[model samples]
Target: MKILWFSNIKLTETQMSGSGTWISGMNDLLSTYYPDVQIANVTIAKVDTVREEIVRGRSQWVLPKKTTAGDMDLFVKIIDSYHPDIIQIWGTEFFWATIPFETICPNVPVILDMQGFYSSVLDVLYGDLTMQEIIRCFSIKEFLRPSSSLIALSRRLHKSVNREEEVIRKYKIISVQSNWVKGNVNLLNPKATIYETRIALRPQFFQAVKWNLNRMEPYTIFSTASMIEPTKGSFTLLKAFREVKRLLPQTKLLFAGSIQTGIRKSGYMRLMEQFIYLNGLSDSISFLGSLNTDDLIKAYLHSNVFVNPSYAESYSLILAESTYLGVPTVATYAGAMGELGSSKSLLYFSKYDYRACASKIISILTNRELAVKLSIQSITFSEKKHDPKTVAETQFSIYRSVLGQLNK
Candidate 1:
């Protein structure tokens, strides 16, 4: 089967975010796990003629118009030429809105895989009259016209988009994923199918030599993720660590991942600078900038614990990756993180409670036996469920199921 994947995130080396990372993994999965299946990834890149071509091809705006056009045209051209069995739309806003669905092979099924449908709902719910009208254009017809199936990464996202009666009727399958498996599907007029998909660990990640257990040093609490402003709760993590440092001066905190540009610089970095200066934690805290897949694995291997204090998320890839690597996790109850399984293996606090989050970190830090137990469970959970092999097979099943429905 030939699959065409569309996303706005840059799939190249320069891009750094969850969506980009996922896109990269999708390509790898298609190439390695399902070699028989042909996959073409179409990402938006800006370069003049390609932008115009994409605009003409009905591509929707995902990012700023500078470097995303080439990727858009590539998608349209590939669809016209290869006529793939599946056209999968991953992420939102990036796929050009103007791309005429009817022109891209009438019957080819379009699968909308969403991490957050709330963006659309929020836009409609809170936007001005013009914004509401623009969204309405996509609401009743254009958006629904192309998709045969809709895939939401979480139930919250499903709820966000599934409210519209017209949307409910137009799509055939709607699914949401927990860490383990797909949930039930509702196939009414605005038919719905709920499926579960985990953020599976890639094979390349496992290839890294396991950390030398014997060489384990003082536990370092760490977190690595996109540096988005809202919901990431980097500030909470830092403040919590500050509290942790107050109790245990020897403990170290490391912040990894890139600084997101446009979103206000309210993430961990700025918070770290302030917290360190005000409380004098410069020596205790460290910032490890963006890391590639390999470096990330190394960070996970070396760290004693991982903390993600995001205010909201569909599911934190960082939390999943940390758990998979067997590092004890410290996270807030945001997104589908609680669904990560086994509270015993993780230390979670309320979404905005930094003091409680810090206390939990301190709990594990001071107790060696408990930390060891948590680490073992974290590793076990990650490998057993989230290994790339399992994810590939499961996704293949979903793809096949959608294809079967399309064929019928």
Candidate 2:
């Protein structure tokens, strides 16, 4: 079976842009586990013309992001050439990816994969920011960029949400990673078939040594974000961290992500800086600018607690990986994070409730017995959900069922 994938990231490199870290693993596992399946990935790049490459026996296509008359013609031509038995459009956030759905061979089965569904994400775009904070979070850079602030993002997300609804209604089958996404998709299209699926993790996570209390840095916390935007709930966590600081002065935070640069700096970042400065948290907080997988895993293994303060997430890959590494974590009860925990594995606090969030973080940091319990359970839950063999087989099964290959 030839499967064609439309995604935002190319799988040819270690650091391809976008959120599908599992694509490479999925491709490899499916190829190894089920030899009959042939897969090709198509992604959009800023290149002037279309390009193609072979990566480990799979075809990789890079098309121009801008759709010119010739570009659409060429895109259609490629689709005709591949003649895929299954067309999988990964992540609906990029509206351009779904452009060829009906235009291509309509008989072929199509599966929509949810990555932080814009429709549900639209509801929590501002995270915990109040109207006053929203106004305060606006900066000259945000004014210049216009789209960086929460206000502009809300408008853009509203448009994306409309597109998402259309896509959701048109597709009969979709694969979701979280129950939160399943519920929202049901609201949009009740008749649509939903498959609960888990994405594979990078090998580094599975191979790395599990969290050991002896190796952990006392009073140290670790967190991650692609970009520390307001919606990521950075400020919400900052507020809680301040309270934790009072109780535990030695507590330190290591944020692993790119720091906001000259143009990228927004009012929200400025607001966070002020929060840190005004609260005397500058000495306690450290930002470990963009790290590779090895370095990220090292940070996770060293920290006492991992925190996810996002206002929303369809499924947080960081949380998943950390939990698998046996890191005790405290997360906000926002987005699908609320669905990520049981009484045994993870701890949760309501969004924007800094006091409650602080309490949870403190509980884990101070209680060694509780921390070890969480660590053990976290691994148990995460390893089960992210088992590469299980994920690959489940995905192949979905494809088989779609193509009526189940009985055979």
Candidate 3:
């Protein structure tokens, strides 16, 4: 079966990142495991590497990101050329990605892959940062820049949320990853048919370095997001870390992205910079900027615990990675983590409650036996859910089912 994919990232790049890595992995997997299911990808990225059907086994059209009517028309031509049995749009997060809806791909069956809505995140974008904290973090210079200003960011996100909601409501079929997403999707468009599916992680995560207690830094904590935005819950994590340090003085917090000196940071990050020094956590926090998968796995292995402080998530891929590798995890009961940790796979606390967050982290740190038990449970669940074979099969079946329903 010919399947056309509309993606936000150029998938075949040497340095794969985030959701793109898993999508490319699944594309390759579907070809090998289900040989009949052929795939093609059209990505919106800075690079322009356009290959046709004959040039590559499957066409990968990388269009320079544009949201014009002309771009949509050209996309139509590409779709006509490929003539896929089904068109799968990866996410509803971007304006460029909203092109291949039912209106554009009228004749074919299109399934919107539900990858967390910015509309849902828009509400918690400040990530539990109170008005007083906001007043403290406010900067006239940063606000003057327009792009990094808190007001400007909110306006842009509001626009994004409106577009995302419209796109989702128009699409009839969607693939949901978690209960949180399913709930949100129903609210946006209750008439839409929702299929629950699991995302496959990159191959490296499945077979990479495992997190063991023996190699862990005594009190090191790892977080995948550098808290580039408030939605990532950096402020929440930082508040929790302060409390954690007061109790366990040796504790260290490590961020995946660079929060280094001599860098222009976001409004939230600018606040983070001030808070770190104000709290005397200069030595306790470290940043590793832009990690490839290998380095990321290493960081995860070396840390004592993994924390996902996101106020919301469709599914935290790193959370999955950490759990899959049996790394002890603590997360807020926001978004899907509650459902994710329902099996007692990981520990949880109330969202935005730094004290509860600290308490949960402390529980994991102090009880080696409980940590090991949580790790094993998480590993057991993750092994089945993210098992490459299961993931590939589930998606392929969804495609087949989508096609089957069209006939009915």
Worst 10 residues of 2 by lDDT: 11-20
lDDT of 3 by residue, 288-312 (tens): 8778888888888888889998888
Lowest-sum lDDT 10-residue window in model 1: 145-154
Off by over 4 Å in 2: 15-18, 68-71, 225-227, 405-408
Greater lDDT among 1 and 3 belongs to 3
Over the stretch 1-408, how does candidate 1's per-residue lDDT look in tens digits? 877666765544342444446556655565678878766555555544433223212223223355433444555665776677877766444433334444545687776554543533333231122343223323222234323111122344455445433343444444355522121123233245554554545555666554334444565887863333324666667678778887888888777876533233432234345557888878886778777677778887777677887765566677777777677778877557787757877888886688999988888777778777887887777677677777778778888998888778
What tens digits encode model 2's per-residue C-alpha lDDT throughout 210-323?
999889998998988434566677887888999999999999998888787776787878878888999999999999987888888899999999998887788888778889
Among these predictions, the greatest lDDT belongs to 2
Poorly placed runs, candidate 3 (over 4 Å) = 13-15, 47-57, 67-70, 100-105, 258-263
Least well predicted 10-residue stretch by lDDT in candidate 3: 47-56
Q: Order of all candidates by TM-score, from best down to worst? A: 2, 3, 1
* Rank order (by lDDT, best first): 2, 3, 1
